[model samples]
Target chain A: DVKVTQSSRYLVKRTGEKVFLECVQDMDHENMFWYRQDPGLGLRLIYFSYDVKMKEKGDIPEGYSVSREKKERFSLILESASTNQTSMYLCASSHPSDRTYEQYFGPGTRLTVT
Target chain B: EDQVTQSPEALRLQEGESSSLNCSYTVSGLRGLFWYRQDPGKGPEFLFTLYSAGEEKEKERLKATLTKKESFLHITAPKPEDSATYLCAPHEDTGRRALTFGSGTRLQVQP
Candidate 1:
């Protein structure tokens, strides 16, 4: 079984504060992604990394950034938190090949930006 | 633009009620289609992946079938534990690793 773990299940941050969400996967997958879930928006990708030290912006990447310095770890960074940024953040990892387009997800981090 | 649309935004069913959720998609070329189940306050758990038309996959009481333009997830004699939000995602031919997701259909099964 694949396991993806996030640093925190819940987080609270004040406006303008910097926040970081960490994710680690045990499957040695080369693709990792960050997404935010809202009531009506479903899950929109914020950022994704195909390899260590490589990244790509997704549909809603304006307010978020990601780092993939190591193969098993990926980090999402919010330079300055805002109330509008509060949402359920999810981390997923997957193997790009072998028809493994199915991504394994973590429990998710509910971030509250106040 | 590539898109995925799921219908019957919400459904309420008795324990034994049987129904199906629809996922319609429009993409340049379909690479794959995925289904996921999500509970409140948690991330989505993968359910099925349909790679081509006329394909079908089943698990427990849930069966997924796919066509060129859409997919259907049929639930049979569902239980209370089957209540969750079902999401539909489609991978386009853009060659990117990202998937376009539908808003999802929330299912509620009462005992």
Candidate 2:
């Protein structure tokens, strides 16, 4: 079975701290995505990588960055954490082929900034 | 913008209740439509994928049907464990990677 795992399920950080949320996928998929889910606003994409070292900004990429140093691993970095950045962060992976449009998501990391 | 919308922001059902959830889209060309069920704290779980009009797929008590402009997920005799937020997304024809998602409908099944 395909599995996606995140580094943490819940995280609390202080303002101005640099936070990192890591994710890994067992399937050698070519696409990885980071999204922040909030009430009323739904899921807003932050960044996505189609391959190692290739990243694209999504609808809400401000104050967030991603790293794809390896095929199985992808990381989301908040350069400066703030209270507004507190939200549930989700990581997802999918195969490159168009057939696998369905993305496999991790359990998610609920971050709280204070 | 590849827009997608889901109706009935919330739905409450009793055990064995039958209902349907709707998802409408206004993209230029429909590449694919996806359905996911998300729990309170966990990520959304993949449920169904409808490719084109007249396409349909079923698993357990849920049946998904598609048309030119919309799709429907029909639940037949739901259970308490089935409560979750249902999400719908439409894949773009060109990129095929990015998906435009709807606001989702929260379903609470009462036992």
Candidate 3:
């Protein structure tokens, strides 16, 4: 079984503060992704890393960035947190070589910016 | 542009009732269609993966079928524990590993 764990289940941050959300996977997947889910809208990709230190911007990458210094860990950072940035952040990992392309997800972090 | 759409935003069913959820997609080239079930405040759990048209996969009371342009998740004799949001994502063979997900169908089963 693939296990993906997030650092925090819930977080509250003040405006203009920096926020970091961490995710770790035990499956050693080659692909890691960050997404923010909102009501009425589905999961929108924020950033993804295919390999260590290699990152690509997803559909909504603005105000968000990611880091993949280690194979098992992926981190999402917010330069300046805003109320609009408050949403359910999800982390997922997949092994591209599997060909099935099914991503295993973490429990998710609900960030609230005040 | 790739698009994935799910119909009947929400559904309510009585215990022992059966129904199906729909997921329609349009992409450059079909690679795989994935189905996931998400409970409240939790991440999605992978259910089944459909690779091509006419492919079907089943687990317990849940079965998934794929066509050229759509996929259906048929729930048979659902129970209260079967309630959850069903999400479908289509992977396009555009050399990118990202998947475009649909808004999801929220299902509620009442005992």
Find the candidate with the highest DockQ and give its number.
3
Rank ordering of all candidates by DockQ, starting from the highest: 3, 1, 2
TM-score of each: 0.95, 0.94, 0.95
- DockQ for each model: 0.75, 0.69, 0.78
Query: CA lDDT of each candidate?
Result: 0.92, 0.91, 0.92
Runs of candidate 1 with Cα error greater than 4 angstroms are A98-100
The lowest-lDDT stretch of 10 consecutive residues in candidate 1 chain B is: B91-100
Candidate 1's docking class is medium
Q: List the residue pairs that clash in candidate 1.
A: none
lDDT by residue (A1-22, candidate 1, tens digit) is 7799999999999999999999
Ranking by TM-score: 1, 3, 2
lDDT, candidate 2, B1-111, per-residue tens: 538889889999999999999999998688889999999899988899998899999999999999999999999999999899999988778653467788899999999
Provide the lowest-lDDT 10-residue window in model 3 chain A: A95-104
Evaluated on CA atoms against the true complex, candidate 2 attains a DockQ of 0.69
Candidate 3 lDDT, tens digit per residue, B63-111? 9999999999999999999999999999888976567899999999999
Error of 3 at A96 (Å): 1.9
Error of 2 at B60 (Å): 1.1
Interface RMSD of each: 1.1, 1.3, 1.1
* C-alpha lDDT (0 to 100) for residue B39 of candidate 2: 93
- By DockQ, is 1 or 2 better? 1
- Output the better candidate (2/3) by lDDT: 3
